[model samples]
Target: METTEWFSEDQATFGDRVAGAREAAHLTQKQLAGKIGVKLTTLRGWEDDLTEPRANKLQMLAGLLGVSMTWLLTGQGEGPTEPTEGEISPGVSDILSQIRELRVQMQDNVKKMGQLERQLRAALKE
Candidate 1:
């Protein structure tokens, strides 16, 4: 699955969505906070799901991120979709698909590595 689909609201936390949207918008945490008139810590909290924005702020955030407020809250409404380069050529699209596949494989490999490490440690302790 594409990274965008992998990180769908169903699979990701509110903070994860926020971070993803922020990155898609090409804004840093500090910059987003500044644009939204919040402190960096507050933005961090939102992105970490430690806190949520109020209604007004949420509206502002949705607008700034070019997504719907509902999407931000539930990922059900209009949220950021995978960006398509202007008239994506076939070659570029194919490469993008391959990249997504590689990313999934990488994630699986990482998980397997972690499991192996844990097993190794347990065996060494025996």
Candidate 2:
């Protein structure tokens, strides 16, 4: 069967941009699927442009891939320049800020996980 395109004249579908970015990151469908917590077949469907991701999933996917949500959702670049390493372009700065935020969140999650693990062990010992 012929696949219907999800986007219009001015807009690009969220799925296509996601698939392209994933490929650009040198990730396979299975790897992207694992990262996004989706099934491999579901990821393949997205890659084949079969359907769009839900709202929250889209945001999480964009965050995990380190691309701007605007670019991921609408294929529009947010006027940030691409620079070489340590060049500090405007876009790179924005990306770096996001990376720092993610790092903080990850550290918090690790601490929380450790606390939970300790509580579980203590309970089990009791």
Candidate 3:
């Protein structure tokens, strides 16, 4: 069976890596832009490979996506991977699965908080 290499520096561009990481982190473009203090358009540009982020933004992006800057930029360090069955020890697999679940929960919580904030603002205006 064929397998997809999720991250390969030689095969994917920088923008591709960024987009992949962002998706893996469960962040929408707007959400990530807000966190990084950039405009939605700016983030789109980066993901589209039409432009590159400055150093500070790059650092922030790496942090927010839970990836190393080197990996995001060149796919040369810690990055996402999905090992096949038996590829990792059972304990390692369990830990990884737990971590993935926690990340999803965290992202969901962030979304819920944002919704509550918006609702509170609307209420305050009444």
Candidate 4:
């Protein structure tokens, strides 16, 4: 049987590790944020790679999610294992990859829009 590695440092980011661990722990973003004593937006930011948590919150997140801080930071230590065969169908996995790509594109568009809006406001003020 062939084994596939999941969430390797080269293949995944801190946000990906965080999301995977949170899901494996069966906690919603809101629930995890509450447990870690952070706002939902703050947790969302971390999961989206828009921002990172402070040291104390990072510790809390690692503990609550049952993953190592190193894994969360670098995907190099204790973390979720790869899914076994039939755990996720290829079709479903493809769909999930598409969704992640769309999310990244949307985030980029949002940043561009924010910059344009700022530029427009400055032009109006000129």
Best by TM-score: 4
For 1-126, candidate 3 gives per-residue lDDT tens digits of 122344445556688788878877788999999999999999999988899999999999999998889987888898765445666676765675565556557768999999999999999999
Give the per-residue lDDT digits (tens) of candidate 1, residues 74-98: 8777777666656457676677567
Per-residue lDDT tens digits for candidate 2, residues 1-126, read: 121222221433566567657755678888888988999888777766787678787777777777777777666763122344555566756665565556557768999999999999999999
Worst 10 contiguous positions by lDDT, candidate 3 = 1-10
> Candidate 4: lDDT of 33?
90
Candidates 1 and 2 compared: the better one by lDDT is 1
What's the TM-score of every candidate structure?
A: 0.62, 0.49, 0.61, 0.69
Per-prediction count of colliding residue pairs? 0, 0, 0, 0
Ranking under lDDT, best-scoring first? 4, 1, 3, 2
- What stretches of model 3 exceed 4 Å from their correct place? 81-126
lDDT of each: 0.81, 0.65, 0.79, 0.82
Candidate 2 lDDT score relative to the true structure? 0.65
Clash pairs, model 1 backbone: none
lDDT of 4 by residue, 2-45 (tens): 22444546546788889999988889999999898888999999
Q: Could you give the candidate ranking by TM-score, starting with the highest?
A: 4, 1, 3, 2
